[model samples]
Target: MDVNGDLVHGATLTAVLDGSTQPVGLLGALSQAHRIQRLELPVHTMLPVVLRQLMLPIMLDELKAPRDRREWGDRFNRGQFSADELERLEHYLGPHGYGDRFRLFDAERPFAQVAGLKALNGETKSVAQLVPSVASGNNVPIFSALCEADELRLEPGDAVLWLLHAHCWDTASIKTGAEGDPQASKGKTTGNPTGPLGQLGLVVPTGRTLYETLLLNTPVVPDGLAPDDRPHWAWDERPIGLGCNSPAAPAWSQRPATGLLDLLTFQARRVRMFTCETEQGLRVNRVIVSAGDRLTRTPEYDPHTVWQHVTKPKKNQPHQRPRRHISGRAAWQGLSTLLAMDLPEQSDGPYTSLLLRQIGDLRADEMLSEHYRLGAETSGLEYGTQSAVVENAIGDDLPLPVQALLAQDAWLREALLECVDQADQAARALDTLNNDLRRAAGGDPLPRDKGSKPSAQFLQSLDRTMRRLLVGLRTVGADESELLERGQLAWEQSVWHAATSDAGLLLAAAPPRAIVGRTVRNGNKDFVYRSGKASGLFRARLTDILPRAAEERRAAQKEGAAA
Candidate 1:
């Protein structure tokens, strides 16, 4: 035959019984089948080459004899064989016809070289030899379990041998003259010559051939095989053919199936490893569900709902914690207002006395009393028991003589008197306001039964106003004393006006009585004359009598000290 201009030889056949064929015929058969055109050889080869190829299996059989015979003989003698020895013997017997032949071959030589002659041919030595060895050797009987046992039984040692043989057979089939069944090489390499056994019409079965042999020979149970009895390489599931059924499928046919099976198996193992039948598993499941729910579900409320719930007060809510009281500039403004109210101002002599009386009507009397009470309370003392100590001390009241001396320097006199007047006025106003505050806060009302009528609430309000006014006066008295000491009490007109108008005696006095005036002169005929006697007498009583009495008492105390 010729293919694509390459010369093709026909298929070559050999008889298992005869070791004679031409090498040309064998090469021609391979060429025709593999579509090979030329032979890259040193020379053309002939018949003995073919015969040698045919004789390979027989030679392999002969070589297998000593190993098998020795193994079987040892087992018969010893009653047991190690796993390795048993495996070697089984492998030796798998391809050969019978134990008798193996023994005969062991006894014979060059019989393998003889064509058309069986080593065990009609010899009585053959039957007995076969019987005992077959009975003793752990081969056919053990492997028979592959066909008979419901589940394949394999020992650990057997599994190791099975894997080893599987790999070996696969490797050997590729290399020429390697020791595996020639029939097993049928579809392996394209141009390879079939072995003598293959030519004798034996077909190699895939998958289980090696595995089954090992399973039968091994003492251990083949626990790994319960899931699938198929050979290790073919155990994977694959898609069945959609096309026509032809020759055996390719080795790669099960790839997709094997991958899927492995994936499923891995998932099963993971499930077994990670899952628990407890609350912990429930928590894990909840966490997974929560994560997935967050990704997929719509929110039920606005995101700010939590913040609003925290900040907003509910209906009928209980009272909240009180904030700290902060009195800043407004408190100062209140003080200022109280300071600027109208009260009585200071005057000289009996006029000073009358001014003091009018200031008392402004309720400064009550404010002074309250101030004294508060001071005594703070100091843990009785009112009037402690001597009055002015917070901002001032110079003693100026006598008329001292006043006259200061008046000689008009500017200095005016400054000193102005300070005195301002202090007195501010004190009166603060006292009045203090009294008013007390009244407003429902303290003791002023006496309406003393020939006058006023609402009790009005009286109380007046007392509160008086209290505030007195507080302002006290503040100004202290401040003005400081200014005097610092020498900064300049009499600004506006301040004077505010001082006199708000808290001076003018506010308390009645309009003066209108008088017709006349002039008098010592030498002139007609002069205006006026009598100022009553006012002069009153002033004389205040300035001379009262002060003279005080001086007399002080002088007596000094005399007593001396004594």
Candidate 2:
């Protein structure tokens, strides 16, 4: 029978029957002739039917095409022809003939002939010669034969066939010990021996490397001695166990399989994809449903529901790790600084408190010190305890409460008291001068000064003097006129005291938080005020005046209406 034309490369038949060059060559020629004739054959009846006739015993093996047919069809419909083009490839040779003379060749005969040639070419050796000798105790010949065969580019199938044939010959030559019958048991053994020809082991020719192929396809072979106990040939010695345990099986088994069905059913009802219709330009609500189920009802599927569901777990989760606590000293210091600073809005209070707590817990001062220490270490410079050094530097200049602690020494307290006494006496003298001018002005005297000199001019003179005194009291240094204008206008209308009234009494009773205040441009200079408590009280009094002024304006409007 002709063999070459039917043995196509990359086909399941070629893989099963064992392909050789001569058979491949014959197959290529036949395929070429068929193509030249432009003969059309049903895909199912094409090469498969011819392969069965060429190979004896007709072993049928099925192999997946390595790609999804439906997907390939879709691609082809979209003008892609890759799958079809790949199918047209002819990678084998066959007989050159036409009509009845041209016929499919048997692959087994040519493959056996090739195996003989391979053995003769030093690519393989007889099993008797390759097997380890009992006397020598070495399998060097076997290893050398296999190495040489592999180096010759012989296909694994061809090598296996050659070894099987050699093993059969070796078994035939072996003499079985019997009663005066050396030739009687020459070809026969007690075990039937199956001869090496039938002892051929199958090696699955996967594209992966040996290690990778074994890792991916090694089957759970049964542990037994009997040949009949083995699994089917298709499994390649692998046991007939479960193909593979489902990865999700353990988790799924922990629950019921119906759990997934339930989840999928629930999800299908709840989930939806947003789609827009270009025609109406109106948002139409739609319901989500499982496959084959109709979405007849219009149910609102808010996309925000997905976000809420997904984020809910993350949002409501409690932190798993332990949190650091803020030290009392650090918390107090941070809270003190926050309280002292004037924030832009009342809303900042909570934010500032949170920030202070965070900073305190993070050991901000210690972190700053460590950062400075690291910088100093890298640069080879001495950086002492930074916080301590800073505190020492500002010992006398910190906030009043802090400064008081630093000034616990007798000398520092004495110096501070003396300075306070001097400032108080100066402030008192200034108050007396302001009172004298207020008395001379009589209550609401002329809005501007008039008359140039002496008694008639004294009241006029007092107004000018008062203006100069007010300017001096408001100003610390340069541009006294500008300073007086910028001072709170409400203070100008305040009742003045001659070193004894409420203003004077308040100032004398308690010292201001700051004896002197500085402007952006002006350095530190004296400016009088009562205590922080008194300032707060004064602000409240000023706020109260707003309603009284409004009432007086209403009365004036009524009088005008009467007139």
Candidate 3:
């Protein structure tokens, strides 16, 4: 498929079945010896999730053989597979096995689709809807040149590309209602749930080599297959209309997932593409889209999300839920959550992904090194009311040292998490400074964007410094407690400087009225708002917020008493 002017090779069932598919190369341009220089469609964050989904079943298949999970990881680290394993993988993925049912468009069966969808819906819409970027229907083109007027056309390959994306990350909106669903209103279903991936602030663990990445993301399954578990493609019988096995039950009905395979290959939406034989070969012109399976509850074992204990619970059972990513926020801002492990019992806190914990085990075993940099790539859609429209598509990659991945709340992880909190505190202090300056000038409270810009910029300035601190921490030895303290202090100083710089800006921008002084009511007593008072307040807040600064102040006060 030619996406963004680059040709991406599509993986075939045959290649995947024979264990010949190089997923890294398929997703990006490969350098000599099969190294991915950079990811193609870098903003297409769902691709990695989909790729992982594809490879996981294969991993499960391989583990079903007589071999330890550690042995597989060791072989992956060496970039070699046993001949017996290769043969078994082929048989497992082949047509003689599960691959027989994996078809893109078959008369009797289709991959991730209701076979008679068009006939059931009795309508089809332009294929432009498949491509999220292209404006179609009532959606006005914001950045895209193509609009409803433009001849929106897609080749088979591109159609498939977007088709997969639709299943994983499609926006929630009104959809065509199939015949079997009981929830349909006039042959339509409104308020549909967003694709499962849309619900997560997905963080995928990436490694240098494709083999290593596959193994890193694939969790170790000690006991092989659950008897009834299978991916969507491996289902023996086609799903009938909007129902699963039950003909009367609607597809919109919520149910618990059978296993990881079921969750990954879940048909989030029922879709059918109509193709035409053109001079340019087969092209998809129209498609039908509707809701597929909706999850009953968020899966606790989903490996791609950072989990945090819910302070306020809507339900009593799940103390944790996947953290949602904020738009325009750097991944490092959530470093504490991303690197967090289990807290001491009785202290329920944020935790890293299960897959990441597995990767940490690899690092502990020396299969991966402390200095070996890995990346945490995050992606998710920010939706408007009922997820009816796409507000923003968020995607970012933060390269992290292996020290951050150490198990059981490693020292580096704890230290980095503390620095992140300190940074947050500093940012809040700076924000308070800005608001106080505005108040002194007799100005009303600033809008959210204007008020928060200073703090946001302050954090942005600390990005490189934070990364440098991470690098430094990677080199620190376990016995070097004092060295670690010094490093933490250094990081605190960076935060101090960043906050004060923003404070300086606020002071410089202070109005003449603020300099002269203003009297304001302080709970029935008059209080003065002057430049000096504002500066003093800022300094006091900074001292309280910064640990090192506070310690220094306490030491000076104690010496003064001694004198």
Top-scoring candidate (TM-score): 3
- Give every collision pair in model 3: none
**lDDT of prediction 2:** 0.22
lDDT of 2 by residue, 1-563 (tens): 22132223422122111122222322332333212211121221122112212211111111111132233223323332233332333211222211121112222222211101111112322222222221111222322335322312212223222222222212212222222222223322222122211111111111112111111111111231223121111112333342321211110011111211111111101011112233433221221111111111111110000011111224544212111112211111122222222222422221122212222222222221111100000000111232111001000001121111121222222322332332233233333333323322332112234422112221222233333332333222223435433332222222122112444443453323232322222256633332343345443443343333334546879999999
What is the alpha-carbon lDDT for the whole of candidate 3? 0.67
RMSD of each: 55.3, 41.3, 5.7
Each prediction's TM-score against the native? 0.12, 0.14, 0.82
Give the worst 10-residue stretch by lDDT in candidate 3: 25-34
**Candidate 2 or 1, higher TM-score:** 2
User: Mind giving the per-residue lDDT tens digits that candidate 3 earns over 416-524?
Assistant: 7788888888887777777677778987556876545677788889989987887677677667889889998788777877787778878999988888777778788
Task: Give the C-alpha miss distance for residue 20 in model 1, angstroms.
Answer: 99
Order the numbered candidates by lDDT, best leading. Answer: 3, 2, 1
**Candidate 1, which segments miss by more than 4 Å at Cα?**
1-408, 445-486, 490-563
Tell me the tens digit of each residue's lDDT in model 1 across 434-546: 33332333343244334222122222223333334323332233235454333422222222234334322321321222012233344758533222322232233322323
lDDT of 2 at 454: 19
